[model samples]
Target: MSDIRPKYKGSLLRPMKALSFLFREPATLPMEPREASEVYRGFHLNDWEKCIGCGTCGEICDNFAIRMVEIPDLPSDPAKGVKARRPAIDYGRCCWCALCVDICPTGSLSMSREYIHVSRDLDSYLILPDEAGMHGENFLKGWAKSETSDLLDLARQAMGELEPEARSDNFDEVTKGFDAQSALLEASRCIQCGMCHEACPAHMHAPEYIRAIWDGDMERAVEEIYRTNPFPQVCGRICTHRCESACSIGRRGDPVAIRWLKRFAMDQVEPQKVQEIALKNKVSKPTGKKVAVIGAGPAGLTAAFDLAKLGHSVCVYEARPEPGGMMRYGIPEYRLPYDRLDADI
Candidate 1:
C-alpha cells in the first residue's frame, strides 16, 4: 500500500447543474387512485343471504355497538341455524376491528373497498348493511381472508375413537372422548360469544362450562352443566346441538365440538364424583315449601329439580311407569342409556 496525500480534484459545478431540474418539475402522485393491496381492511360488505342473524357479532362486541334486531319478514329456524334477528351496527361505538367478520359463522360478513360514508343525520350512523354498498355503488371487496391470516382454525381435531373395525364387534362406546391435552386445545379455540348458549334448547352455560373445561376443571364444568341440565350424559350424546350451528368459529372452520366436550368432561369423573361436586353448591336448609309437579319429563323434571333444590318438597306425578318422559321412550337406548337418566333423577 502506498501512502498518498489527497488532492482537491472534486468539482461543485456538475452537482449545481442537477439541482436546476428540481425547479422545473413539481413532485406529483399518480393521477389515478391506487388500488388497495389484497387483504386491506376497508368498508363493510355483508352477504345477507349467508348471514343467519345469529347475533354472535353483538355478543362478542366489546363496545356494545351491535344490536340484534328482529326482521319480521326474515325466516327463523333454530334447527337450520337461521334467525329472524340481524345485526344493526352503531358506528359510534364500532372500532371496525372486523372481529364480527372473523367470528361470523356463515362468513357472510365482510368489509369492502368503499371506505367513505357521509351522513348529516346521526341516525344514519346506525345502519344495517345489506347487499348494496354504503353509497349504493357496488365496490369490490377489500378486506378478506388470506391463506396466511385467518382468525379461526378451520380444521377440528379428529377425536380419538374406536374405529369402525374395532367398534363393529363391540358394544362398548365408540368415542374415546378428548384427553386433557386435546380438551385444552379444543377449548382454547372458543371466543366466548355465548352463541352456543343461545342456540342450546336447554340453554346450558356453554361458555362458562367450556371455559371450565379449558381450565381443566371438570368439577366446575359439571356444576355449570347441572345448572341447566341435570343429565349431562343424555344431552352430551343425544341432544340436537343447535349450538354448533351458531358457533362463530364455524364460519371459517369447524365449530367446536361442544356436545362432545360436555360429554368428555362429564365422563372423565365418576357419577359419584359429579354428584358430590354438584351438591357442594346445594342449599343446606330447606325452604319447607311443598310443590306438586305434574310430569317427569325434562321440562317437568327440571322444574322439579329446581323446586326440590330450593328446599321445597316436590312430589312429581308421572303418567308413565317411569320418569324421563320422552327422553327414555323416544331416544334410542344406544344413545342415552337408562343408567344415565336414572343418575340425574
Candidate 2:
C-alpha cells in the first residue's frame, strides 16, 4: 500500500479569463427583431372577450406589479364572478413569474412571444392588457398555465358523515361537520377566487369567511357569513353550493368544501352570538314604507330581512305552518338537523 498521498496543485488564474472571448462579437446578425417560439415567455397578451376581470392575477403576483384598475365602460358582472376591473401591469417592476397566468381562473390571461418594445414615456411601461398585444398586434402565445404546473390544493379534505347503519334507528344529523383542525385545513384550500360569491344565489362572501376560518377567527367568519346569508346554518346544511361547480380548483381535483367550512364556522360560534351578529345591521328607525313578502322560504325571508333592515314594514306569508317553507317541510331531519335549522331562523 502507498503510504503517501499525491501532492495538491493550485492555480492563480482568474475565472473571468474564460469569458474574455464572449465579450468579442464573433458572429454578425441583423438588428431587426424576430418572432419567438410558441413557448417563449415575452410580453403579456390578454383576451378581453373571455377575461372575467377577477383580479386573481394581481392577488397571485409576488412582485406586486399588477393592479386591478376599475374601467367603468367594461362589463362588471359580479353575478358571474367578474368585476369592471382590469389588470394594469408595471413592466418596470414585473418579474414575469407567470404566476398570474397560472392563477387566472378563466384562462383569459396569457403571454405573447413578442418581446420587442420601444417607449419614450416612463408611464408607457405601465399598461392595461387587452385582447391585442402591447402594439395591438396578435402575437403568438408563450408561457401559460397548464395542468402540469398548477399551484392550487385541488383535492378536497374528506368530510365525515354518519353511515346508514349508524343512524338507521335514530333521527340525527347525517353529516359530521369538520373539527377545528379539519376546518382550518379545509379553509386553507381556498384561493379566494370569489367565484363562489357570484355563483351563489345570495352572493355570499364565501372566500372572506373561508379565510377567516383558516385564520381561526370564528367570530370574523360568522360576521362575514352574516354579510349576505341570513341563514348560515340552514344553507350550510342544504344549500346547493353552486360555487363549487364554478371553482377553478375543480378543473383538476375536487373543489374545496366551502359548504362544510361554513357549517364548521357557524358551529363554532354560539347561537346567541350568531343572532346578535345577524341583528347588528338591523334598522334602528323604521321607515313608513311597507313591503309584503309572500312565502316564508329563504327567498322571501331574505327579502324581508333586507327590507325590514331598511326601516320598511315587511310581511312574509307561507303556505306551511312554519316559516321555513321548503327548507323545513321538504328537507328531512337526517339531512338537515331541525335544531340547527331552528337556530338559523
Candidate 3:
C-alpha cells in the first residue's frame, strides 16, 4: 500500500471538542433573573462613611447617570472631606464603565455581582448607593478598580518652586506654575467633573475653564472665569479652595491644583489681550439699562461685571480706595500681590 494511504488513518473516535458545548452553560444567560458574572458591572455599592459627596462621578459621567443627593443626617465638612450629599446612581443612565469607582477619592465606590432587580416602581431605579446592595443584599464585588485600569493620577505634578535656599531669602512667589507641557499633563489628570464647582462657594466653572486651559485657549478660560467671577487674580491666589477639597481626583490622588492652573492661564495672557477678549463679549452699543450694583467684593464685582457686559450702565461704589473690597484689605499681599489685583481691575 502507498505511504500516503497510511497518513490518512483517521481516528475512529473522532474529535470530542464538539461534545463539550452540550455540557457547558451558555455565555449569554436567560434574562429571567439570574446572578451576574464574577466581574459583571451590575450595580453600585458606596460606602457612605468614605464618600465625600463631591459629585465628581456625576461630573465625569459621560452619560449624566449620577447625581449628588442631599442626605440630611450626613455630616458636611470640607476639611475632613465629608458632604451631606451622596451620589445617587440612575440605573436608567449608567453605562457600567465603572469610571466613578476609579475616580472616587475615598475609594468608597464599587460594583457588585448580584444584579437582578424586578420592580414596577421607577423610583427604585434611582438609588443613593450605600454599603448595602440594591436589595440590601451585600454581594461580592464585581467591577472594581484594577491596578492597571485605575484612572486617577494619585500623585500630583511636582510644581516647580523656588529652592528653599532661594525662597527663604526673598518674598518672591514660591510656585513657578506649570509650563506648557506640564500644564497639559497636569490638566489631563482632571476628569472634567464639576465636583470642584459644586464645592466652591463662588461656584466657579472649573471644568469648563480647565478644559479651556487644557485646549491652550488661555484667553477663553480667562473669559470663562470672568463669567462667574471678577476676582480671578484673588481666587487664583488667596481664596480658600473648597474646589480642591471636593475634587474627585483628591479622593484617591492629589487634587488638581486648580487655583494654580487658573493663575497660570491668567498669567499666560497679557492684560491687553484679556481686555480685547473681554471686549468681544462686551455689549458695545450700550442698552442704557442703568443697574446700581452694591459692594466691590467678588459677589458685587461679579454682578457689576455681568451688568456692564450686558450693555447696562454700571458703576460700582467702593469704600476702600482699591476696587476689590475685602480681597484687597483682608488677603495678604504675599499671597495675592497688588499688581495682579490691578491687572484684574
Answer with 1 or 2, whichever has the higher TM-score: 1
Q: Which residue pairs of candidate 1 clash?
A: 43-112, 105-251
lDDT per residue, candidate 2, 29-100, as tens digits? 768777688777778878777676767788888889999898899876554455677799999988878888
In model 3, what is the error at residue 2, expressed in angstroms?
A: 32
- TM-score for each prediction? 0.73, 0.72, 0.70
Q: Among these predicted structures, which one has the highest TM-score?
A: 1
- Give the range of the ten consecutive residues with the poorest summed lDDT in model 1: 144-153
lDDT (CA) per prediction: 0.78, 0.82, 0.80
Higher-ranked by lDDT: 2 or 3:
2
Clashing pairs for model 3 are: 105-251, 105-252
Q: Which of 2 and 3 is the better model by TM-score?
A: 2
Model 3: lDDT of residue 1: 55
Ordered list by lDDT, greatest first: 2, 3, 1
> How much lDDT does candidate 1 score?
0.78
